[model samples]
Target: MRALIAVATAATLAVASPLLAATLGDDGLHKTDWMRDTFKDLREDLAEANAEGKRLVIFFEQRGCVYCTKMHEEVFPEPVLSDYIEENYFVVQMNLHGDTEVTDLDGEALSEKAAARKWGILFTPTILFLPEEVPEGQSVSQAAVSVMPGAFALGTTLDMFTWVNEKRYELDGDEDFQRYHARMIQERDNGKTD
Candidate 1:
């Protein structure tokens, strides 16, 4: 009887795993277990993220964004990708067209929409990956290690997350993100997902 119950529990978890990735907030943005709730100050947020031994990630999305919904439903729900992100990143959500006040790293205060514009974010679901150590006087965008715009497939998103988390951007190799992504694709095709 105990063995049967254990098997049933495992089966239930297998079926429910994907549905556990993302949840919709009252504000209409996707929320997950890993996203942080902070005061929207980039400097303080960076400090907090570094203290937690994670890289800071800024996620931009607008209300009623189809791509954002698709990402929350499809790509982010994948356990490998979601777990990687949750383990390595401290995510902060920003509304593309919101009035929330955000303090830039350089001490500039602006509304969320204005800040997004200042950072040259022109799309929904843009993810700005920050380095662990940012310079004192730089803005968030100016100090970002990599900026991922738009939604991507599981392989691409996972590759990007891994590359940034591994600090591959700081490497002196000629293999840029494009090359790294291609290599990841090949590895996946060869049945090595990691």
Candidate 2:
């Protein structure tokens, strides 16, 4: 019994250690050292994107959301996807339940949690694609080009990334995402001969 207890205790410590090291917010999100940024800073990065003629992609997630956890653990860690995101988009990770204050590009100070609320971000792992400047006096609905919710496989995620990168949405329409994504998979399986 004593040996069993000791083993259980060790296992518990091993599991809890990493979580304890992570900074957890109200929404149960563990803010790790990597790929963590506030919404305000994300907006600033968006502005930089505008200046540099790039696109802005923001990922809103909460702690304890299974899908979000899967995304961070599985998809984001994939080398191809990670490398593409790091290079092409001004990626920002925001905690939905964090209370930290952030300053927007428009010089407005608001809590990160408040910003998530204002954006109507209730889902875990919601990815928002935005243009350089969120058109003047327009709401998020108008400014956002795409909003993808939930966790996706690396292949589908990469296809979405490629579609956005190539501005396929502009010509192909929103529903085309799935179709194009399917084709991408098929081509990859066929060794991308065409």
Per-candidate clashes, comma-separated: 0, 2
What are the lDDT scores of the predictions, listed in order?
0.89, 0.70
Put down candidate 1 lDDT per residue, 14-98, tens digits, no spaces: 8776465477888888898889989999888988989989999999998899999888988997888888888889999999998
How would you encode candidate 2's per-residue C-alpha lDDT over 18-133 as one tens digit per residue?
32233555557745444435346555677777675667877788767888777776677676777787777766667777776765545556777787777778877888887666
Off by over 4 Å in 1: 1-18, 191-194
Worst 10 residues of 2 by lDDT: 18-27
Question: Deviation in angstroms for 182 in model 2?
Answer: 1.9
lDDT of 2 at 31: 52
Q: Evaluate model 1: give its lDDT.
A: 0.89
For model 1 the TM-score comes to: 0.89
Candidate 2, residue 33: Cα displacement in angstroms equals: 7.7
Per-model TM against the reference:
0.89, 0.71
